[model samples]
Target chain A: MTRQFLRHGWTAGLLAILALLFVFTKIIQPDFGTSGLDSLSRAMLPFAFATAAMAVVVIAGGIDLSVASMMAVAGVTAAVLMDGAGDGMTAVAVVIVLLVGLTMGAINGALIVITRVPDIVVTLAMLYVWEGVALLILNGPGGSATPWLRELIVGPFIVPWLPRSLVFLAVCLVAVWVPLKRSKLGLSIYAIGSNDLAAYRSGVSVGRTRIAAYAVCGLFAAIGGLTLTMSTGNGEPIPGPYLMASVAAVVLGGVVLGGGKGALLGPIIAVIILRLVRMDLTLLSVDPNVTTIVEGTIMVVVVMFGGVLAYRGRHK
Target chain B: MTSETTMFKSVGRFIGNNPLVPLLILLLVLVGVLEFMRPGIVNERWIGNTIKFAIPLAMLAACQTLTMLTGGIDLSAAVAATISAFVMATQVPIVGVPLAICIGLIPAIMIGMVNGFGVAVCRVHPLIMTLGTGLIATGCLQVYQRFVIASGSVIPDGLAWLGTGRTWGLPNALILFVPIAILIIWAQRRTGFGRLLYALGSNETASRISGVRSWQVFLALYMLSGLIAGVTGLLYVGLIKAPSLSLVNPLLLPSVAAAVIGGTSIFGGRGGYSGTILGALILTVLGTLLTLLQMPEGLRRILFGLIILTVTTTYIRLTEQSR
Candidate 1:
């Protein structure tokens, strides 16, 4: 039991944080269990997917500043395609949006590899380009959340205690994340991120791993975009500022920034904690801006504590 | 044939040795293009206006270039600038302008100190520390605004004059800019502190092994970045004649772009600010060209992003081959 608990490491701490926030929120709202959690889960889907996207890219030793931009593109693309489409076309539109996102991600990876530019620089530029693409696609927002998509996403609870959003979240984890975590691609990602030169010497093909990482990121970002579209009932032109929030959550989740270590689930939990922080502030009727301050403080202070722990472990 | 080959080789060597020359040439070419597109647009007045707009941008970018020298970035630079400008503007009506400005700058310095402490003493990544601090500062500003919004803000007269006034075909801001520019350039080349930044960026472990207190350098460096950002903010408010919550937020990415375009390597230990100055001018010119076309905002941004990518890619390729 002790060994297993030790193996869990930061995940345990993250869960503790999540639980603390949950209880605090529960206190703030007596009706928090059923309706509150359902709405929160609905709100969380986009961020969860985005967090997964960021986790994949960061684990591969690269940062994708364009994740939010990619989501905007995907969201707007789907919004445009699904506009007044029937059920069949709506499904097809979803597939096309996924493909569009994957293609964009592939292009980012190729550009980074071929240009030999730093990932941050490449992604930063792409952030602008993709945002432009999003604006062009949906110039003034609107056009999303068709009846089918709305029902499919948010209509009825599939299970007694669970939300449809959580169900979709589980599907993504079980169907996509777990398999990726177990695959050769996952191993390659860790290899390159930890030490690319050594990995190259040992025949890991750093370029391919990076491309795969970003491609996966693009797909997940598309999922986030889709969820956002359905949940909000329209596409927004602005790439929401999920990039920093996602990064903060990633760090708080114990995904080492220089890369190569972390669980995908850790960030998902951290996202909930972050959302709860906002929820708590909202419930308290304080200024909306304090939420950002608390979140930023939490991220920095948590990371600092972790750093101190690591330093001590090193000395020991 | 031998003479031609030697001439080509010598030209390549000259470019490789002084990378700033090509960037300067590019700026001139961009100015010429803008002139061709609109005719009579690249005159003394045009020069004055372009330099005026580019001044705040380049000053803000100094925060980036200086930090990039040490393989770190001050992501909070924009936020610090916004806070300074907003605070100074709001407080000017209550306290006198000079005192308001000084008080406004204190937050930026405190942010800088926190960034320094987090990054240097706590060993947090500079990106994370500045980002966190930037958010905190923004939050604090919002809190401050709640109280001050009832009172309203007034832009300072001296700043307004410095931002918009012209004297003998030159921007009045130049009076302030010339000394700042000279000091930055001179310090980058002449100061021991500048050499220390290069040394630390090149090899932090090696520098520490040689007894350089890395923390001291980082604390000073980040604090300086914060100070520059704060001053740029104050100047920017004067130029735009507006103070909002996100007054300088838009400059954050462009400042990074300017530094990178000037050939400052993001990974650190290479490049200089002279090229960055040219890069800022080129970007301003490009923005002007895009506005002249009068395309949709979306198309404008697309072209803008495309142009920046093409320029940086081409510039990097050119510099790489020369070396």
Candidate 2:
């Protein structure tokens, strides 16, 4: 038990920090309650989903610069489909949206494999392409889902302070990712990420695994988009702010940027911590510009500290 | 029909052998198309203008080429460039042009050094390190802007002349660019640092075993990339004559694309500045073609994505087939 605790020490540490951050938030803003928690969770949804999307790709030894763009496209498509819809329509729209996202990811994967171009270059271009497609789908922002649909996504769950979106996230994690993470495909993802040539030699289909990883990323990005749209009651084609932030979050999550190692919980906590920091700044009435600096500084400082710790660990 | 088929294959063989031929041919074809669309648009002055614009992009792509050569990337380059340009533009009123320009560059150099430290000493991946540093630079720039926003900016007379002026039917940028271009191309081939970059990029373990100090190479490499990005920023601000928060951020993607299109594989180890130079020119020409087509903004963007993917894939396939 003690050895297991030590092995997973960082997990506990990160959760503790999150708890501390919550306490700190409560102290500063006295009115902060279930309502605040609810809003905060809702606000973090898109990025949390994006962080998940990016993490999967990173762990598979590839980076998808177009994930945010995919999110935008999915959001717009959902908004278009679910708006002014009848009963059972929103569900159908959602399924279609997921399909759209999956197709997009498959196309991205196909392009990468067929062209033999680097993932960064291909996805970088795809990012712009999808962004344009989002705009083409809806010339301007003005699209919204039905009231019930919106309620279903961002509304309170069993209790007032608990959002359905958060619940949805938890269920999805258990229902989808856990099982996938233990599957052969998942192991192959890690293998290719760690060393593709060796994995290929060992009978892992590197291309197929990479494509599957990206496809999974797409499905999550679609969920992120739908939730963002529902929460805001509108959809805009502009790329969500999480595009680059997802990369930062994934790295902070202890995912090696070169690939093959990480956990979902680290990024989840990192996302919360990042959000809390921003929230704290707002509550403290710091200048918006200073907030940017603080956020950036925190990212760098934490990583540098982590690096030092790892170095010491190696030496020890 | 058989004769024609043989001729086609031989032409393919010719193009595959000369890697730069495709990019150069595409550039000429695009220019020709533009000319065909609207006669007399391909005059010497217009040619000079295209080169003028291509120079900054080429400079930025140089950062990508060099860094990607080392199996890393500098994502913060655009941000660093923006910070330098913004700070320098704002500092012009108080510090004068040259000193302000130098002052503008300090932030970029510092950012580069930090990026280098993180990637080299801390072992942070260059992508993340550069991205983090880039964000920090932007944040710092925002804070710096508060104090300097009131002071009106002045474009250095020299930069404006270099960015916009023409000398004897050629862009005045050539004076500065020629030496810089020659230096980058020549150094990449001849300099010890250049060889180290390729070596480190292609095989870090082997290079390390061969007694190469990998970290030192990264430090110098990132710092140099920062300096290059900084210079590009200065020149870009001069070109646009307007300094915004995102002066060079927009070019970030294009520069990476240009490097890729020019045949600098993002995975590293094989590519050169000469190709990147042509890549920059080709992109500049392509931009002109898009604008002339006058397509909708979204369509243009989609077209750009398709073009990049198709061209790169075809180029790689052709090159691979030749081998």
Candidate 3:
């Protein structure tokens, strides 16, 4: 039990920090109740999903610079279709947008494999490509989502205490992450990430695992996009800011950037903490620019701290 | 096979071994296409304009090329450039142009040194380290803008002339690029430090074992990257005739893309400024062509993305095949 606790100490520490921030926000704003929590969840869902998407890719020893762009593409596609096809076709529109995200991810994966190029290079290029596609789909961010879709995504849950966004996140955790993390494919991803040549020698399918990781990442990115569309009721062609936010969340979550280590829980907690910190700052009437500075500082500090920990552990 | 077939095979081999061949071919093709699109794109005025626009990017790409050669990257490069430009613009009023320009380099140099310390001494990944510093720089700039620097400060006339003025039928920026290019090429080929950089980049452990101080090399390279970014920012202010926060934001990714397209492997080692120069030119030409076609911004971005993808993939495949 102690070994297990120590093993996940970083994640535990993050959870504690999140709890502290939550309490701090509530203390600062006494009116911050269920309604405030609901809005916070709604605002955080996209970034939480994005962090998860990035975590998966990073764990697979690749980084996807296009995740935010994928979100934009998916959001724009859904928004345009929802606006044009009406509420009756919401399901079909979502399916198509999800397919778009998957296709984009597959293209990234295929290009990385076929060209033998670095993941960063391939994804960076795709980031621009998808952003362009998003802009092409919605030139100025005017498309709207159907009310039904919005309710389905961002509405309160059937149970009064739970928000739909939280429910959705829980579902994702239970349905996708829990199962995938214990699966053969997941193990293969870890193996390949830690050392691709060794994994290949040991009969793991490095290429396929990498592609699958990216596909999963894309699926989550699409979810993030849908959530953004639902919450905002519109599509934003420029989703560049979310890219850094997602990365920051991943780092804060205790995920190793070099690959082969990390859990989904860290990023989820990190996301909430990040949002709560913003909420706290807003309640305190801090400057908006300070938010970016704080976020960046946290990212650096967490990464540096992690580096030190890893170094000490190795040497010790 | 006949002798003719053998000759063809050898020629194919030659092209395969040399990464620059395809880049040159691509450049020629782009030039031809641009000329076709606009009947007089081949003329001096247009070409000069293209090179003029490319100069900043070329310099930025050179900065990227240096760090990339050392297996590191500077995501904050554009921000670093912006900070320097902001400093120069704000300080020129108080300190005059020459001293302000010299003072402007301080922030860039300091930031680069900090990035070097983090990466070389602390062993943080370059991406995260530079990103953190970049955020700090940007935040500081925001604070500076909000509190200190008044808006609407014009660039000094001397610097503006160097930026826009031509000498002996060449754009001054281009003229400046000549010495910068020559210096980099010469340093890379002739200096002991240059050899150490390649050695450290190619195999850090081996180099460490063989008496190369990897940290020193990393420090120097990162510092050089910062200095170049500072110089690029100064020139950029001249070119744009003002310093804005977002002045060099768009160039960040393009600079990295240019370095990659120029055959600088992002992983480290095995690339040069010469290739980056060509890459910058090609990108400038592409941008010019896109504008001449009056393509919408969305389509233009999509085209640029596609070009980066296609060119990079082709180059990677060619190199893999040759190997």
Instruction: Say which candidate scores most in TM-score.
Output: 1
Model 3: per-residue Cα lDDT over B1-323, one tens digit each: 69999999999988876778888999999999988877765987776778888999999998888888878888888988998998889888777888988988998988898888878877888988898888878887787778655544658997788788876667888667889999998887789987777777798889999998887888878888898999999889999986888888889999999999999989887788888989998888888778777767778888888889888888777777788
lDDT of 2 by residue, B87-202 (tens): 88889889788899999999888988999988888877788788888887887787877787779788888888888889899998888888999999899999999999889889
Regions of model 3 farther than 4 Å from truth: A84-87, A153-161, B1-18, B149-152, B321-323
Encode model 3's per-residue lDDT on A1-316: one tens digit a residue: 9999987998999988988888888789988877888888888989998999899999988999999999998988888888866665988998898888778888888878877889999899888888888888888887888887777656578876678889888797668888898899999988887899999999998888888889889988998898889889988889847787888788788778878888899998999998988888878998877876787777777777777777788879
- Estimate TM-scores for all models: 0.97, 0.94, 0.94
Pick out the ten consecutive residues of candidate 1 chain B with the lowest summed lDDT: B303-312
TM-score of 1: 0.97
Residue A199 of candidate 2: its Cα lDDT? 96
Candidate order by lDDT, highest to lowest?
Answer: 1, 2, 3
True contacts kept of each: 0.60, 0.65, 0.57
Write candidate 1's Cα lDDT for A1-316 as tens digits.
8888866778998898788888888787887776677788888888888888999899989999999989998998888888889889998999999999888888898888888888888888888889888988888888966786776656337565677778778887678888888998889999888999998999899998899899999999998999889888888879897898889888888888888888798888899888888888999997898877887898889888888787777779
CAPRI-wise, candidate 1 is: medium
Best by lDDT: 1
- Candidate 2 residue spans exceeding 4 A from truth: A1-3, A308-316, B1-18
Q: Model 1, residue B239: displacement in angstroms? A: 0.3
